[model samples]
Target: MTIPLVRVHGVDDVRLDNIDKPRTAPGDVLIEVLLCGICGSDLGYIGMGGLGMTHPMPLGHELVGSVAEVGERVSHLQIGDRVVVNPMAGGNSIGNGGTEGAFSPYLLVRNVAADERAVIKIPDGLSVDQAAMVEPLSVALHGCRQGNAKAGDKVVIFGAGPIGLCVALCLNYLGVERLVIVDQSSHRLAAAESIGAVPFKAGSNNLGEFLIQQHGQSELMGMPVPSSDIYIEATGAKPVFEQIMNTAKTGARVVVLGLHKQSVPLDLANVLLRELNIVGSMAYSDEFPAVIEMLTGGKIDLQPIISHRFPLSQFSEAIAQASEPDEAIKVLIDCQC
Candidate 1:
């Protein structure tokens, strides 16, 4: 019983391979993967060699699937139940080098009864594709939470990628009316605009002037600056962080969600002078259920951010499409296809 999966072998190398199917244990639950999203971190891993493992490591964490086999000891879940998995669960690390990832026909959820956050049943009426988006949306929601984003705060996001767009959706759902998204792609900007976020092209105009016009203006050291209350740095580009630090008004909170592979020089002096609150957001914590509730209640629509879809067999093509920020926003892989 062999199953096909995607893994990273070495630098600039990622491909599908066949491995022995996992056997279900008494405390484990098996899931037949329905959909998995290609994350930017997956691409970063490919470019930077691998997932820092001696052997080929499985890749992909943003996923949702149906329960295929429930172990005898697992009473909370039943076969055929649709669920979203928390990859960071202790003793059941999926898609992050602990166990087999979701980019396959089946995934074994170990220690089902031990951790409550391990597997969550997807509520009725949520589409399968949208359910697959829960993981990333949780990440976006965590970023917003780290920034302590609240209602009536003027927010500016420095990227229009999946996380950036999802952050906009989360902020909007939280009753934040004024939101602006900056990106280099018109297509992604259009997607952001479709989600009720004001879109500004990254390099086409002066972002500081535009931000002042949209969010209002304030003075830092007697110099005019954008008065946005919150600034989320979702773009991993070094210059984007510098730009945010340069223009963030006094008392503004900046949430760093992007993964910066190389070291980024920060202006500590400006940060101190302006009294900026710069915080970093890791994966997620206690955000899955909240995001799911928002989805269940129709608080936000993730459908607009879904830019492309491909079958598991076409995984390479999907990776290529996902790498192009100008062409795609969120690329999903249909594992059950």
Candidate 2:
């Protein structure tokens, strides 16, 4: 049987194509996709052609679904179980150049095991939309953990996009009282304000002075600097990174969560002089359950972060919506629709 699935044929080329539904193996589980969220990386993938694959690559990783079929060897999962998958783990990665992607009517998760925990069951009372958010939220949580965020710390996040906003949510949940979000878009800045973050327009004024105003000032190499404890780089813009390095306080930790296509020049002398710790956060690591718990406990409200939803049939429209960073954040594709 064939089903509608989204595939990236080449650069600036993606389409809804009818593809054969994957057959479940002995250790595999079949999932009927419910929703999938578009990532900023998806646009990058579209621009750079497929994920360096010879064949058309499947797109989408942040997804939630119901278990349509369970393999005989899959003891942990059962048919009809509502779940979210960790695409980075196991051989059954949906999307990321995998044979099957979440932007389809169904997905095949391979190699289920007791220890892997690749497929996580969503507890009752968590809506499918909330469940779909696990992947990206996990990414945000991982970013926070990388920054070693703590209570009472003043944090500044660059980029008020989905990940940045989610990072703000995570920081708040972790009890970081003073939080500021910087973005170029007024629309997204307003969204940041809605979630209790101080919205600082990207180029409105000197970021160093603004940070000092919000987080107080400290001396770095005998010069005044913003006393923010942590800075999260989520915009992937070279200038933002440069700004962070130039203005960050001594002993500050900079967590980079965004994908930078080109290598940006680094000032090693400044990093050494300021004693700054720069770390990179990729995908996620064991943060899914924490994000799920926060969502289940209602500690974070994801509704405001979500800006658009499109049905699977209208994936192109969804992609177009997501491409406009000024207007959209956390655009989701309803697979079941």
Candidate 3:
């Protein structure tokens, strides 16, 4: 038997091809992918061919699936059980670094019994779409954890994209006193507003000035400008990074969640003077269960952020839609459809 899968051959060159169905080895698990989300990093890989990819690469990481076959040694999961896959287990993250991903009819979870972090069973009441979102929400949760956002803290997120919106939602759920989201897209800002974040148009006004006018100046001693307790740079835009670095409050925790395509010069003096705690967050580890719990408990809603869905065969169109910041928030690929 063969399976249909999507792979990137070159820049802007993604194609669907058929390959042999993976044979179930002892201790392996076969998953029938249900849903997968197209992330910004996937777009980057599609557009640039490889940030470091030396060969054709599979694309997609945010995914949920059901077990189709379980190896003899795989005792934790049985056929027909729904699960959220952890792509990063054993340094073999799906859709990244040459690992084949969930953008296919099936996926083989190799050596599942060996890695305790292999997969998490989705709790009841969470739809497959919601379960598919666990990966990105885990990313947002990790970023929030890095920032150390606490109750009554004022937070500013510099991007209203999916990750940014997720960050806003996580911060709000953490009992943030005030949450502001900055983005140039009205559609995205509106989405952010719907989630209880105060949205600010990035180009219409200076971010610092707008925050001061809306939230009033910061009262922290020795701080020269109005600022938020936590500043999250989620846009990966160099200018946005520079802007936040220059205007963030003294002793603020700056969380970097977005993947920067290129290195941008940082104002070391400002960083040193303000004593900003710049934290870099990578893909999640140990945060998936918390995100799932939050979803199950109604602490956060991811449905609204999923603005578009496309069948796996329409991945090109899905990628195009995901590339448009004004038109889509989180674009999903319905593998089971």
Candidate 4:
């Protein structure tokens, strides 16, 4: 039997092709993909023709699925069990280089048995669609954890994209005193506001002035400029970088979550003068189960952020929608639909 899958051949080249169904090895397991999200990095890979990827890469990491066939040696997972995959653990991370991604009808989990480290069983009452979000939520949770966000601290997140909104939601759940999100798009900023974040239009109001008006004078700057306890950069834009450096308060924790495509000059003097602590967050590390608990317990709501959905066959349209910040927030592909 042939399975249909999405493959990227080169820059701006994505195709739905039929390939042979993968055979489950003695210790392997096969999963039927239910839903997969189009991430910002996925768009980067598609646009650059596998920019940082191996050729003919299958591109999907945020995925949820069910066990179709458990290999002879596998003991933990049973057939028909719903699961949210942690693609980072196993060497064969679906959609990355080591293994084929969930873009296909089926995925082969090589050698790793179903466990908390590799996969987390979706709790009762959580829909598969909601489960598909665990991966990105974990990413956001990790960033918040890195920033050491605490109760009563003011947080200013630059960018209202999916990651930024997720970070905002996480911070809100953590009991931050003030949560503000800045973005150029009113559409995207509206999504941020829906989750209780104060949204600011970047171009309309001067960020520093707006912050100062909303909050108060920066202790370090001693001027009418906003200074936040925590500053998160999620836009990956050069100007936002400068804004963060200029507006951050002394001793502020700056967490960078966006993947900047180009290099930007850093203001080392500002860092030295203010004694700012800057940190970079990557994918995630051991934060999945906490995110799941937050979702199941109703501490965080991700439903509002999912702006659009497309069938697996319409992946191109999904990508296009995800690419437009004005059109969508979190675009998902219904693999089984």
Which candidate number has the best TM-score?
2
Candidate 2, 1-337: lDDT as tens digits:
8899888999999989999988988888888999999988778878888888898888889999999998888888888889999987786556787777889989888877643477889899899889888998899999999989999999999999999999999999999989999999999999999989999997788888888899999997689999999999999988889989988888999999988867999889999998999999998879988888999998788888888999999999999999998889999999988
Per-residue alpha-carbon lDDT of candidate 3 for residues 1-337, written as tens digits (9 for 90 to 100)? 8777888888889887777888888878889999999988888887887556776788778899999999898888888889998898855678886457788979887878788478678877888878988898889999999988888888899999998998888888888858888999999999999889999998896767788875568643565577678889998888888888778777889898988879989778778878889989998879988988888987777766999999988888888899999899999888865
Query: In candidate 1, what are the lDDT values of residues 154-266, reduced to their tens digit?
Result: 99999999999999999999999999999989999999999999999988999999999999999998999999999999988899999998999999999999987679997
lDDT of each: 0.90, 0.89, 0.84, 0.83
Q: After superposition, how far is residue 246 of candidate 2 from its true place, in Å?
A: 0.4
Q: Count the backbone clashes (under 3 Å) in each candidate.
A: 0, 0, 0, 3
- For TM-score, candidate 2 versus 3, the one ahead is 2
Q: TM-score of the candidate numbered 3?
A: 0.96
Pairs that clash in candidate 4? 10-49, 11-49, 95-101
Angstrom error at residue 172, model 2: 0.7
Model 3, which residues run further than 4 Å from truth?
Answer: 51-54, 219-223
lDDT pick, better of 1 and 4: 1
Top-lDDT candidate index? 1
Query: lDDT for model 1, on a 0 to 1 scale?
Result: 0.90
Answer with 1 or 3, whichever has the higher lDDT. Answer: 1
Model 4 root-mean-square deviation: 1.7
Candidate 4 matches the true fold with a TM-score of 0.95
